[model samples]
Target: MKYCYYILSVSLLILIFSCDDKVDLEQFIDDSEELTLVYSSISPQDTILKVRVLKTLSSDNNIEINNSDAFVIPNAVITLSDATNNSVRLSYNSDDKNYQIEATQLEILPGATYFLSVMVDQREFTSSCTIPNNAVTELAFELTDNLNNAGDLKESVTIRFLDIPEASNNYIVGARIEDDAFDLFLDFENRRFITDQIEDGALLASFGFFNNNPDSVTDITLQVANVEPILYDSLFASYSNKENRQNPFYEVIIPPNNIEGENAYGVFAGFQITERLITYQ
Candidate 1:
């Protein structure tokens, strides 16, 4: 009788362990698989739209579908709105990973507001920007024969407006010379100036009188880089010898957007008189 009772207790213990194991298995089976989709708009401000879609694994269960591969949505729809509140639809480009909208459809204009909205996998994301007006300040280097001028020479000749000043934010300063005789664009690639938060200050472009060209007056203009109004007229103008123009000097003070308004901002514009222009005497 004693042996039978011990055997029965062991059997009960085994049954309890087996039931617990089964319960865990059922819990695992009851869990549901989850799916998520992500979308990004590369050019949020321009009508020439670009978007990337990604589908990610959201569940721990082993699913049979190929999650490693990126499924292209050929029929994804995109829309862009202009500053005038007009919106146009864009079609997906089958040849690439993005959907492109025609620039002509939006009638991209300077100082116009714009926004981009993308739909992928039933999820939507959007961004907006007021197309910056053509805000450029003119800079000219006036060389004087006198060498006693110190403060004037130390001053920055190029004047520009800062849109943002957070660390790692990049700003582009551009200059163009426009005269009735010649409309010249400076070589920004060879002459473009860039500043970072580490070198915090108002946006400026500087040219020293020490480089010669005493009478040259540079008509300067500054705009946000890569968005509109081709910074350099052409690749050739980047290195051309077009003479600087005088009169109708360009200057404007742009109030920073809300994001950039907190910091102290001012326009730094000045010129220095250096050595006389030498003609290879």
Candidate 2:
């Protein structure tokens, strides 16, 4: 497969290191009540929104939980309420082990908030997030192998767009490159966060980066997403924990934002996405 590149920024790295991990050893509390683990994210652009629900692992049952059926919570009731206050319950597909609801049923709208609730063993997990009102405008790109200020040979793509002035917003741009018969999806590690602090709402934003593997990119399709802060924070913590697995001093995973309760873990997020395709010449 060819390579899809995501240019990472310093702020994104900071977020990943800052948030709490969704899955980590610290969450394995000794309490008799099994803490419910939840993960879900939704977008108007998605056809199906899925939520993964699981119980915190215990010392004795940790091995057992590793089995597919043993870990998955069967018949869990997952409900999603739309901006109109209408609710749609997600059905559990035992085959996929996820609670799923069709996107059309949710009626995801811009600038609207959506709520998610899960009933597991009589425990109710609830969380809410608003969809940001913005889309990638004038999205265009150009590839170059030009030398930077450091005078090193750098192959990069210049991604330019307009930032909508809203409360504070975070953005991630990803590229899937097609070369020969292979289609390579960009790795999440390459995701960068775009913040609108300085310009407020008046600035043109451009994100560009040196290609890590230039030869692997021939044609690319870029997906720019305006992500909710909670979603961004959750991914930061979750991905950070996964990336630091090789380190000896691994910090416990910080639990994700589960609005259901303080100890609840996982994300209920929304994204507004815009896509553009550019072929490398």
lDDT of each: 0.33, 0.61
Looking at model 1, residue 13 earns an lDDT score of 9
Q: List where candidate 2 sits over 4 angstroms from the true fold.
A: 1-33, 62-70, 146-154, 177-183, 187-191, 202-219, 244-256
Model 2 has an lDDT value of 0.61
Across residues 1-281, which tens digit of lDDT does each residue of candidate 2 receive? 22221111112222212111122322243455545667676667777777777655445544532354545677788888976779998888877677787788878778788888888767777888788886656576666554554686656666667787656777766655665544334433423456676777654444445334445666666666778887777656656655776899988566456567644656677777777877666
TM-score, every prediction:
0.34, 0.71
TM-score of 2: 0.71
Q: What is the C-alpha lDDT profile of model 1 across 1-281, one tens digit per residue?
A: 11110000011101111110110100111213321222222222333544433332323435334322333445555676766679888676666444566656666555455666556556555555544343233333432332223434322233334433333333333433333444333333333334443555455443322222313444433233422222122211212212112224533212121111111111111111111112211
Estimate candidate 2's RMSD in Å. Answer: 8.5
Question: How many backbone collisions does model 2 have?
Answer: 4
